[model samples]
Target chain A: MNFPSKLIEDAVTEISRLPGIGKKTAVRLALHLLKQNEVVTEALALAITRMREEIKYCQTCHNISDDLTCSICKSHRRDRSIICVVEDIRDVLAIENTNQYQGLYHVLGGVISPIQGIGPEELKIESLITRVNKGEVSEIILALSATMEGDTTSFYLSRRLKDSGIKVSSIARGIPVGGELEFTDEVTLGRSILTRINYG
Target chain B: MNFPSKLIEDAVTEISRLPGIGKKTAVRLALHLLKQNEVVTEALALAITRMREEIKYCQTCHNISDDLTCSICKSHRRDRSIICVVEDIRDVLAIENTNQYQGLYHVLGGVISPIQGIGPEELKIESLITRVNKGEVSEIILALSATMEGDTTSFYLSRRLKDSGIKVSSIARGIPVGGELEFTDEVTLGRSILTRINYG
Candidate 1:
């Protein structure tokens, strides 16, 4: 579309470069910014730039942090002996939202994916191994997705850590709490039955 | 959600302020930006900031512009005698995308919504009158939406422009071209029957 102003066109062009944003959505967002107060735009722009420029990752866990070590990894109350390994910072946030876990996280940055040319070396696997070598951690939980890449990463990590004698576990997969068995997929259904827990 | 970093929380807070973006999507987008190279975020932030700070509007039509008059209003190829009145700059972009119209446009900025405390005085109705008083225009099209506010604005403008001797018309309303008859709503179907046209 021919924009009446180059600034709007340029803004839309840049915004559409992000994941899942199309030209139309970018246009809508850019125009919304135009309708808002300058302070709003200023704050948004500043926040984005500051995040990209000044944001740091935890040296210990590779989670998003403004300091050398993330808050979760540094907190004495958190269970340092159990590390939950996940794909990225968003997964850490998701797990944190459940309020079900109080352990430190090891952000692998991404999982093993041959399709995208990403492998174990592309992730922070070496750092994870280094943490495990310290021997303070007793158990490591693989909290990655159920996708092929997630499974591949879990397998590789388990094999590598087998010699180290640390227990490696994965999050259980079953029907979601509110889901019906009739609607559950075959693989999950089969696994749910095979991994059934003993009744109390 | 507990963010590992304050900067991440701040960024998510600001990004989620846009329309339709919630806290979850904002966190996803913020993390996506973090995963990408710094230049991506830099470009996005720069484009938004530059657009908001340096944008200009057309003096003649009140549309977005980089200079005094917009390109369309200044173009000799477009029909200056015809003006298509619209709600805002997005409408101008939408109509332009059709590649069907070759007329000038006057942006009213907004519709008459008493509930929202917006009225004729709050919009560019006076400026539209001023444009018509120049005596250069012969036809004015009411290319606004088909809502109550749009109809009220059109009626008010027509009443005010009765003495100008300029032809005024609105775009046709009926079932959308590819719309199914069974799914068409009552108002549109009723209007289609009432405004039946002759076919040779």
Candidate 2:
């Protein structure tokens, strides 16, 4: 598409670099910003630049933080003896929203995905090991996704921590709480049956 | 959602302010940026800021431009005796991409929409009239959309230009070029038959 202005073209090109946004959507967004108040654009630019430049990763858990250590890792009320390991900071947010877990979290950043050129070295596995080796943590909950990469990361971590004597457990994989039995996938249904709890 | 950092939350809020993007998508985009190199975020922020701050509007046509006058209005090859008016700058780009029209363009910025509290004064209607009154133009083509607001604006412009002794026309309305007749909507099909063109 021929842009009337080079500035708009450059803005659209930059915006379209983001995941899931196309050139058309980028154009729409750029035009929208143009229509809005200058403060709006300034605020957006400031927030993005500040977030990228100033945000830090927790030294202990590798989670995104404003300080050296994340709030979850620093909170005295959180169960320091149990660490929930996950693939991303968003996962930590999800589990935190559930309010069922009070444990500190270890953000792996991503899982072991060979297809995407991601391996154990690319993640925060060493930091997690160091955290576990401190011996204050008694159990490690593998709260990663159910994908193959998640499982591979879990297996790799378990093998590495086997000699350290700390218990390593994975989150359950079964039909969701409200899922219909007939509609559930075969593998999930089988796992649900295999891991069924005893009746009271 | 509980953001691990205030900066992330701020960035997400700003990003989600854009049309068609939600909080979840905003968070995803923010994280994607965080994962990328700092130059990516810097480039995006700089492009958006520069575009919003430095872009100019064509004094003659009201289209977006890098200078006082847009390239279309500045070009000597374009026909000065004709002007195709549109509702937005994107419309100008769309018509230009067709390569069929050699006339200059006038961007109205938007059509009249009372529901959105937009009035004729808010657009570039007065400037269009002023351009037509100069007597250099003999034809004014209304290339606005077929919506109610578009029609209202077209009618308003025609009324304003009725005594100017210039030909006022609108782009043909019918099914799209590649559209199938059987699946076309009744209103479009009816209009297509009513305004059938003569064969050469």
Candidate 3:
């Protein structure tokens, strides 16, 4: 589209570079910023640039943090003996929001997806094994997704840790809390039945 | 949702403030940016901030521009005698893309909407009238939307320009080029029939 100003065109092009945002949405967003207070755009630009420039990855867990080590790994309240493994930092945030898990987390950065050209070596699997070899951890929980890649990564990790003497476990698979039995998929329903626990 | 880093949280907050973006999408976008090269984020931030800080509105047409007068208003190739009035700069781009309209544009910024607390005084109506009184323009095309607010604005402008001796017209409304008659709304269908022209 022909833009009246080069500045607007450049802004729209940059905005549409973001995932899931197309040119139409980009134009709309640029126009919205134009109509808003200059301070809003200034603050947004400052926040994004500062985040990209100053943010660091935790040297231990590989999770995004302001410092060298993330708060979770540094906290004494967290159980250092048990570590939960997940695909990325978002999963860490999700598990943290639940307030149920009190253990330290190891963010794998991504799963082993051959289709996407992501192998086990590309992830932080080596660092995780190094953490486990420190011998302080007693339990390793595989909290990856239910996808094929997640299962493959969990299986790979289990085999690698088989020699270490640490107990390996996985999060349970079942229908969601509010899900109806009739609406549940066949594979999930079957797994839910197979893994049924005794009522208290 | 809980964020691993405070910088990520701030960035997400600013991104989600944009129109049509929610917290979840904001998180996804922030993560995507984090995964990309730092140069991408820097360029995006710089483009947005520079656009906001340096862009100017056309003094003659009120359209967003880099100079005091817009390229369209300054161009000699465009038919200066005919002015097409639009609600915003996007409409000017749309019309220009069609390669059908060659007249100059007068962007009103927005239409009159009492519900939105937008009145004619808030728009560039006075400047438009001043341009019309310059005795150069012979016709004014009301190229606003089909909404009630658009119609109200067009009616208001036509009444204001009644004594100026300029011929005022509106864009033709009917079924879209690829629209099916069976799926057409009754109001538009009835109006199309009422305004039917002789067959070519």
Candidate 4:
């Protein structure tokens, strides 16, 4: 059967690409956009466009930023001596929202998974090691997922940083198995951060 | 606590404006965009930008279109003599997906609701009457919602078109009350189309 016009079709297709948004949901969303005031729709579209055009990864923490260095990395209020390593920037936001974490972040971009063909070299692991070797960071917090890939990356990083004389730690066990840090509510994430344990 | 960066915060705020997307989902979507290849993220952003920049309404039917007339309205295969009136473009799509109706469409933009201050004047009722007055159309189908407002609009239109020497019909009653056409499965919508009844 023939569907909507090509423009509507394309909008729905793009919206469906987002996580958890199926075809029906995408169509609903697209129609809602069409129903909204032109200004709101324009703002939403412009936001997506600006995100791609203006935003870039922080050179130090790999978090999203409009400049070379993210605010967390540049801020004097944050403790640069403790870096919390995470698989993605979503984790950084999750932790930041809790208003608990005072240290800086190190987004690894991804975990090491041989099956998915992602390895240490593909991540920011080398940069992390270099940062640790600088002798400034006293604690490296592994806030990666509890998945097998996350476990592997954590072990590899711990072994590599063993002789760096810095304490290597992982966030606490309140996070459920296979649970994404993005899905964890702010309260649990804050509690997990406060009760972190030593990894080595 | 201090957040990651203003750029990340702004991107998340924009993403959250989408339906069903909360602050957390927005952050996840933004992070996913950040982790993706620049080309892919740029493509998604470009799609949104183009949606705002390129898409426009069909002057004839009011359905979303890139040109003056939507594809369905422009197509010679569609029966211009039978114009199906719907509440929105999404309804037009649902009807099209059935592959049963071969007629053109007229999108009303919304239904008449006294509570919401939406009246016949606010809808495309005037344009519909004008289209019918041209004498080329023989049947005008009301494929609007089954809500009270929908019924009110249908009754109002039926009264106005009583002497127009054209048949006014409505899609069947099987459509659940308050259920949006976008959510109705193809089969149910198709069946409703097949079971349409004369309104006036």
Best by TM-score: 1
Off by over 4 Å in 3: none
Listed in order, each prediction's TM-score against the native is: 0.96, 0.95, 0.94, 0.81
Candidate 4 TM-score for chain A: 0.83
Candidates 1 onward: DockQ, in order? 0.86, 0.85, 0.78, 0.41
lDDT of 1 by residue, A17-60 (tens): 87888998999999999988899999999998898889998999
- CA deviation > 4 Å runs, candidate 4: A1-4, A174-200, B175-200
Give the C-alpha miss distance for residue A99 in model 2, angstroms.
Answer: 2.0
What lDDT does model 2 reach? 0.93
Please list the C-alpha lDDT of all candidates, in the order they appear.
Answer: 0.92, 0.93, 0.93, 0.81
Q: Point out the worst 10-residue segment of candidate 4 chain B by lDDT.
A: B1-10
CAPRI band of model 2? high
Q: Please give, for residues B65-145, the per-residue lDDT of candidate 3 as tens digits.
A: 899998888888999999999999889888989999989999998999999999999999999999999999999999999
- The list of candidate 2 runs beyond 4 A from truth reads A115-117
Candidate 2 vs candidate 4, DockQ winner:
2
lDDT of 2 by residue, A60-120 (tens): 9989999998988889899889999998888987898998999999989899999999989
Provide the clashing-pair count of each candidate structure.
0, 0, 0, 0
**Where does candidate 3 chain B have its weakest 10-residue lDDT segment?**
B1-10
Ten-residue region with minimum lDDT total, candidate 1 chain B? B1-10
Q: TM-score (0 to 1) of chain B, per candidate? A: 0.96, 0.93, 0.95, 0.85
